[model samples]
Target: MKSGMPAPDGIQPARRATIREVADAAGVSRSTASRALTGRGYVAPPVRDRVREIARGLGYVPDATARHLRQQASQSIGVLVSDLSNPFYAGLAAGISQQARKRQYTMMLADDGGSPEVEVEAAEAFVALRVAGVIVTPVSAEVSTYLARQQIPVVEVDRQFSVGVCDAVVVDNENAARRVIHQLLDLGHRRIALVIDEMHWTTGRDRLAGYRGAFAAAGVPLDDSLVVTAGWDVDAARIEAHKLLSRAEPPTAIFAANNVLAEAVWRAAAELNMPIPERLSLVSFDDVSWMSLVRPGVTAVAQDPVALGEAAISQLFERIQSPHAPVRTVLLSATVAARGSTAPPPA
Candidate 1:
């Protein structure tokens, strides 16, 4: 073995410098060295500075796991998001970071990738880490139970529930849907079809309810045949759109539950050679940066995902500070943008 190189695993000599070595070298107690390295407890400013300087000079890196154990806690929050690629969640992540930094906290991020079991696993992992709290966009009701069992304070973002387990910070999904549908109606689109995600999700269900309320107010019969529940993916929505357009009496306009599904509707229209607002009109639930880049520009309901994220972080901290505080359900409103996607239905 080379003299300066690290020895092979399991055959290495056992003379590696320990925490005691660092403390002795720094002329400080072991606890003081630990606190200085991890930036944990209160110590004299001069002693902390001196210990940290010496530890850095000695190329010391403390084991984070060991530090966590010794402290009996971690100064980090766990975040579980379903789809990391979704722009809405990405915006939310940015907001979480903004507020967490303000509170001197860090996040342990977990992207479940839309798997229920993986969501549970992530929650378990967060529990094992002894996080200060959790902010989760739950993929299933099952995750709620798991989080409840862990007894961790949680702030559920972008969805609402009455499970009595955790606080929720969500958008006014029903009102957002209603606003979009009303926009289509004002543009003279009576034959509007609603494309939505699977009803299992709270947002999907609430948006569907909002769609129904809009139709009721507009005096349009709620046609079950015109409503389609696609999986939370563009391809699924595209297939559903194809099937809906294949019908003899196709809708003159479409209302997609979200931006991704809205994109699918756009693609389906192109595939069928249906011109926008000439043969069909469209409206969607969420707006992102790319909304205006599309052909006619997509009309949508825009919500502040970043604000929602910040609210969730704040709510979690509130829960941690006052565990018995009333569990509040916060609903942020959405803005309805009137883009060029909708017009009077063709005669």
Candidate 2:
């Protein structure tokens, strides 16, 4: 029975004060206490104030489970991401968490590692928990349809596989990619190799289109041989870069499609004794911390991942408010952080 001792095996732990206990302490009816705590119905001003103060003094919190059942609205939101190890996804989840907390909702987060099966499983868990809504960087459209069938609202961020079927918050990947390619081309680089993960996702597809668009606009024919399909790992991308750089007629410049590939190409160039912007010019579609910290900073297209997450959560709240409204897509902007990595092709 000592203060620091564990409770007896058969004894139950103390629970938070309930509304009934608060009502007894305040000399008010349970219904009156509920009205005062929720601000949902009228109570005499003085009595309401007195009840609220007593409730606070007793450290009382209403039962969210019971409340959710009565109102059909849960005070928690589910957030699913492709890869928590990636800074982009980490920043995005941080933004979503901040906004969800500010709005007085709990955030349940899950990492799917870019797997469709994992994404769907997380969706199912969210539904089981009765989360008010979900915000996801989805890998497939199946997750959206599954959640929709369960009467759950979803906001897809970064990229979309459910374009017209669900809400999405995304960047204009094409425009950003186009601008970077134009910058390289304007600097007199024609044989520029574009290294990408895959063209299946909207992000990669749009970015590649922009690369091609810039070449077409400048009347420069793109070299098909220079377009390298490097898978999603840093080492694989590095190998692809090494192969491309070792070609008999190597490209004068390389445009990496994302931060992972950017790092890969940067390492490859270093290993091959090619100085950036001297023997090989380099650019990336996404920016990372090392891009700015390296001796010769890498020029990159930067997207605010945090803002993207915040926007996605805001849109999700709006959707919850108007469930029957037409689904819409929000396009965010990205900017180029021009650094020392890009310049005219070597003489």
Highest lDDT among the candidates is held by which one? 2
> Compared with the true structure, what per-residue lDDT tens digits does model 1 show for residues 46-146?
98888878777767777666767877767799999988799999999999988888887889999999887998899999998889898888877767677
Q: What TM-scores do the predictions have?
A: 0.88, 0.93
Q: For this target, which candidate reaches the highest TM-score against the unseen true structure?
A: 2
Score candidate 2 by lDDT.
0.92
Clashing pairs in 2: none
lDDT for each candidate structure = 0.85, 0.92
Candidate 1 clashing pairs, residues 3+ apart or interchain = none
lDDT, residue 152, model 1: 85
